[model samples]
Target chain A: MLPLCISHGDLVKLFVIALLATTALAVASLFVGVSEISFFALLSGESNEKMLLVLGESRIPRTAALILAGAGMAVAGTIMQLLSRNRFVEPSTAGTVESASLGMLAVLLLAPDLPVMMKMLVAALFALAGTALFLGILRRVPLRSPVLVPLVGLMLGGVINACTTFFAYRYDLMQAMGAWTSGDFSAVLRGRYEVLWLALALTAAAYFAADRFTVAGMGKDFSTNLGLDYRKVVALGLLIVSMVTASVVVTAGILPFIGLIVPNLVSMAMGDRLRHTLPWVALSGAVLVLLCDTIGRVINAPYEIPVGSMLGIIGSIFFLSMLLRRRSRAA
Target chain B: MIEFSGVTKVYGSTTVVDDVTAQLPKGGITSIIGPNGAGKSTLLSMIARLIPCDRGTVLVDGLDVARTSGETLARRLSILRQDNHMTARLTVHDLVAFGRYPYSRGRITADDQAHIGRALGYLGLNDLGDRFLDELSGGQRQRAFVAMVLCQDTDYMLFDEPLNNLDIRHAVGMMKLLGNAARDFGKTVVVVLHDVNFASCYSNHIIVMRDGKLFLQGSPREIIRSETLEQTYGCPFEVQELGGNRIAVYYT
Candidate 1:
């Protein structure tokens, strides 16, 4: 009933705080790796080569990868929610990450000598196909309940994950390819993680067409009545979601919950207008992932747990509370 | 003028709208009253091009509804369907402003705001403009959607079951406003209604559809008679003249 309980100036300041937090976590992530590299050490010209190499090849790239994968996946989730008109949709809901993993497993078995970029393209293509399959199913069956879409998408993703696991085990790539498919930033180097920049680019494109996504989310009749090309806008949303998911899976593996939680949180605070909420979603996603990655890096000191494991732990609790919150709000 | 040549709509083996041809006169309240599954909503949806017709073509002012560009058709015609559910959290003013999207895209001009204000005033919704749609009751939300369509300022306006969820006072007010739009503004208005008495009172022309076909079409004086009412509804009816309006009672 109240129009924006939060004032405009306060919203801007909150975002500034988020940016500050993300920057701090990014800097902290640089120093928390196995090698001892601090900002003071860099200022003292102590890197000369080791710190410089660590910062350039390892730390900087990891931080950027975390931010890109986090921000991109979150935006993809937001767009998916808009496109499906479902608040619970995440990038992984459409089986994109599992499909990318399947593509990577196939490349590992069939074309072992291909470069990482080729593998990324293959995985992205597979993600697209998988996403198309899920969307096709959605169109065929009318939803009997609001929860049906997400449930179907989750089961679909599980089936794709089973296929990916079968291939990974059969090809003896379970351990070798597992690191890249499970949200580990340890493998990211300057050249290896460049694919995530493509995800970043697609997120920018989603922002450009934010209003179209918002209108299309209203339903087909509403969109057509407003003179918007509903099918085209929906296609654009699916494309953006698939590309973002694939790039993240190929580059940093499957980071969970960033998309589902970030967009919902932003929309709860700022409403569903894409332009206003997208920046906040991106920022919140980046900050959350940066913090999670930091916790993963420092939790064991010198040894790292994958960001996937960290998010899988923290994200589940967050998701449960969110579900409960929604129930309470509805009541 | 709107013309439908052999318009038919089907779902699987069931025909929702049988092949029919009719020319709707322009610039007045034309009420389409019919029994359930008589294809009233289907016919209205076809005119709006929200649903594709299986056969035939509908022409509005010489422009084919099926073939016209959405932008071109949107400027000339508008339709509000039943079951208006919106997922987005928008205020009444914001929802009404969306009417100008066909004209200004998302950008709001002074002229658009003027139309929005006038529509809100017309619906007695000026005080509720700042309230979110979800915060309003069902009747107010229904009125807000109707105001949005009115703000669109199209030549031909069509509404399907606009009185749903509305109480008697709002329902009468809505009908009077729609009738006035047809009379004072020279807008062609078509509405699908279940209440034949309301249709008899406000409509300049009344159409009765039965079993997916045009059962009858005439002025209220011609269509509200005992024989015509009984035949159209498959029930006995008592017709009475009240305040110069032919009111029908089909209690038997």
Candidate 2:
């Protein structure tokens, strides 16, 4: 009925568009640092020496990391939401973010000399455990009202955050926790940020596995009847979500609400064709984070706000507006 | 044929389906009717492997539902539950196209496209294919979901409360579609219905449940007696043959 556009070519077009948008934002981020580097300075490494070094080394990797992290987190959030059939499920809302933070704190205190991959693996495991626990509670709880599920998730996150904070304070690991809790792109230098590329691979995997995820969202009985391994898809989804969240957390710290807001926004704009919405979510996430980070740098001139803080405030406002709109429509 | 061998489902302490053994023949419309809390939905859910039975097993075409890989069984059976609420924005066509996911894995072939088109057309949803599901009314959304299930093109199609929220005309139309699917397409349709008259008119066989046990089951002609209806529903009912359909009058 929609003209049979479900093809590899359609995917190609979406990918190209998303890549173009992501690349343009990446280029623009190079000029958005404190020193106001120009395009020519970035290209030739010739203008103000301070601006050139910042542009070539710091800003480029930071921008790349932000794009990948934003895209990865949003796509992960989209998949989790689809599978869970809840709009509010994401790394931050589902307690995965706080769980990963606690895990990272454990790694920092216990094994300071551990490899970053090993640390990330530990964090991913922790996030997955937290996600599984959250889903377990959801299954047992009689959630007749759909809104209560997200409220329960938010409460779950609050409890986990309290636990994370207690540990953070007990071990004097608050400093490390603080650094990773609010997203900061400043430390994303070239060598430090390559792990974030794993998110792109995760995004690719999510696309190929989109059908299974969608089927799983149709509820357990319907999905099983259609011959989809419901538990496997759910497990795979949690795995991808945890890995992506951990990678982004380790690379750029925790970016709040970019995952939740971007996917919800894109789903509203164009229906959630996992094949189509994945790229849109990835692109819009890159754009939103890029725009937020640029604004954060420019708002205070020499002093800058962290992108995570900016997204937290902006995303909360947008989320509230959406809720109010839905409430009014229902009324 | 669908076979249930001592199928028992227990939710915690209560056994919802108690050692029910029945054989549903292929290529006929069968309706499961029961009172509230009678476990009709639980029974259908067990058959679809939506919920794992605590004891016993369900065999769809001799393939054990619990042991079969979802992929291997998806081509033969499909089920639609009662409440079909979703937040994802989707047009009718988009929802129907998802039926092909089992066969094509999101890569819809030409045959899959043709099936989607035909299913939509069969549901009389051709004109509203482009309309979003949320934009449609309750009956229309129900029809859209039915179209999606039909598009799945499985031999065994199960629907739980297919007439919920439908008006009289749409409800009649849905029953007719189920009857036609069983008659023309040779589909084995098992529907859980609340309306006795519609079930008696459209379905060849009727299974009744009460208090989590199979109370009675037989052909519609045998099960539509006045005493049977009154006993199953726990209400005084008068069944009269009107236009060759056993119409139950419970208005009193």
lDDT of 1 by residue, B1-252 (tens): 999989999999999999978989998989999888899999999988999999999999999987888888888898899888776666787788888878988678999999999999999998998677878999999999999899989999999999999999999999999999998999999999999998999999988889999889999888989898888878889999999998887765
Q: Score every model by TM-score.
A: 0.93, 0.94
When only chain A is evaluated, what TM-score does every model earn?
Answer: 0.93, 0.91
Candidate 2 docking band: medium
lDDT of 2 by residue, A1-331 (tens): 2233356587577669768877886787787766666787546856877776776688888888888888898898898788778877788888888788878888888888887788888999989998888889888887875567767878887888898889889988888788889998877887888888888898889988877776776667667767777889999999999999998888889998887898887777666777666767888888888888888988997888999999999988977786777678868
Model 1 Cα shift for residue A240 (angstroms): 0.6
| TM-score of the A chain in model 2 | 0.91
lDDT, candidate 2, B1-252, per-residue tens: 999988898877988889998999999999999899999999998998888888998999999998998877788898899988877777798889988878988788999999999999988999988777878999899999999999999999999999998999889888898888899999999999998988889989999999899989998888998899889998998888899888888888
> Which residue pairs overlap in candidate 2's backbone?
A227-B70
Model 1 regions lying over 4 Å from their true place = A1-17, A44-48, A321-331, B127-130
What TM-score does candidate 2 reach? 0.94
Lowest lDDT sum, 10 consecutive residues, model 1 chain A, at A1-10
